[model samples]
Target: MSVRVQADPNQPQAQDQSFSAAFELQGNPDQGELRLYTPLGSTAAGIQWTPINAVLQAHGETRQFRDLAQLITLVLGTDVPVTALFAWLAGQNQEVDGWQVDLSARNQGKIAARRMAPALPAELQVVLDN
Candidate 1:
């Protein structure tokens, strides 16, 4: 899956900070691992999270977070509705307060979602590798 983040232009601090990345997400939101791959296909970073805490390993260094939300926010620059995401991936159209998700292409192993409220809106696109 690949994710593209678009910082809100209205928020001066968020401008010029958008980024894109491809990654493999495994397990469930409660306890899962997300591995980001480099352009050359090597592992760039790995994030593991559980109910108790979250750990990020990258650049030969390991960092810890109090929870998955904190870890995600730190890495993605915004909070993502991960729980809702799992539901979306499973073909369930779940509604999140500040986000809109589209699963119309789930049969084709594709999903798209966008955050429209608060600040620092972002777009998430996922394509399952079959």
Candidate 2:
């Protein structure tokens, strides 16, 4: 999976950034784990969350957060529609506020989405290995 975030013109500090990693996302929106791997296939980061808390482990350090959404926002510099993302991955076209998803290439194991509102704009692209 790869993610690219365009700098928000309204935010002076925001800068364009891109990330690519092999990731595994499990469970539902309320309780789940998202693990990212490096290009060499080693674990890069792991995020696990429940209704109570979210934990991020990376670079030999573990940090806790109030929730998955907060943790994701801090890391990505924007909020992602995680709940809708799960549905989209499952071949369901779910509408999410401020975001648009395209699943035409889902049969080819490809998914693309873009966020057009709410501060930062981002583009997310995923290619399933399976």
Candidate 3:
């Protein structure tokens, strides 16, 4: 899968960040689905920390989280609502990268951790720096 994120360049905001990232995730792994434009996409399988009931897609792939609450409690071990992760990442303040998958499945909901990546394309970075 090739996942590309087109960030709005303006980050570290005092408000929302959810709309800050524009992501494009597509390829063989995500065929027959509208996986082209999204903030982020990930599967809940192989997540020992947050073992979920899981809702399988048509092509036998897992994406849509089935149990949100149980997933969060298991991953975070706290009572933080799972949506907080999404809410925070979707905001326009935080920019990070190379982060581990932190998802908790509990009674409240499934929360996903925000992982930001450093600005890349060395050539582009240098061009923008000047």
TM-score of each: 0.88, 0.92, 0.22
Error of 2 at 3 (Å): 1.3
How do these models rank on TM-score, best leading? 2, 1, 3
Comparison by TM-score, 1 against 3, better one: 1
Question: Listing every candidate in turn, what is its Cα RMSD in Å to the true structure after a full C-alpha superposition?
Answer: 1.8, 1.5, 16.3
lDDT of 2 by residue, 15-118 (tens): 89888899998999999999999999899999999999999999999999999889988776667888888998998999998889999999999999999886
Instruction: List ranges where model 2 is wrong by over 4 Å.
Output: 10-14
**Whole-model Cα lDDT of every candidate shown, in order:** 0.84, 0.89, 0.29
Summarize candidate 3's per-residue lDDT along 1-130 as a digit string, tens digits.
1222333446554332221122232222112111222344453223211233423233455444445455433332322223333333333223234333332332233223433444321110000000
- Please, what are the lDDT tens digits per residue for candidate 1 over residues 1-130? 5456675677678653444567888899889999998889888899999999999999999999999889888887778888998899889999998899889999999999988887556788888776
- The candidate, 2 or 3, that scores higher on lDDT is 2
Name the lDDT of candidate 3.
Answer: 0.29
